[model samples]
Target: MAKITKKEVEHVSRLARLELSDEEKETFTKQLNNILTYVEKLNELDTKDVEPTSHVLQIQNIFKEDEIRESLPRERALSNAPDRTDEFYRVPKIIE
Candidate 1:
């Protein structure tokens, strides 16, 4: 059980600089306690002897097989360039 107390709640509120009304503090205390109780229940679950799996569903690597091929010659590769100089694409200067 997520045991909580008024003093702890008050301390946290003070740290947060929250000017919580008594009613708000009480409500939050109950709500936070419930959340913590749920977490405690989850902690009680038996995870031993369970293999660590990456995902719940089965998935295989979906990719095309790699193949080797000769690359295009530099001259032909740059043939479609808007502007080329010295076998390389050229752009407007940007540095000051």
Candidate 2:
């Protein structure tokens, strides 16, 4: 991999609307290069037998099974509605 140069760092900072001093540019260039070097080292690892996963840990669904249960009656549910039909609440039309 090509080493990150100060000019490339300066260009990126300008595109991001950031103002960096000469020292900051030098620092970022070195830091980016070091990160690339480390990533290059990872290419030497053998991952052929490793299975790809979204997460490192084994995950399973923790949810309980759904059960049928008694619920509030429709009349009681619509008791406080300002406007309601026999089975549902009513609201003013705002789309038109």
Error of 2 at 3 (Å): 1.5
Query: Which segments of model 1 are wrong by more than 4 Å?
Result: 45-96
lDDT of each: 0.85, 0.88
Candidate 1 shows a clash count of 0
Task: Tell me the tens digit of each residue's lDDT in model 1 across 10-95.
Answer: 99999999888999889989998888777788668799887888898898978876888788999989989999899789999979
Q: Which stretches of candidate 2 lie over 4 Å from their true place?
A: 45-96
Per-candidate alpha-carbon RMSD to the true structure: 14.5, 12.4
Compose the digit string of candidate 2's lDDT tens values, residues 1-95.
Answer: 55778899989999999999999998889999999888888779899998778887788868866997788988988999999977978899869
TM-score of 1: 0.42
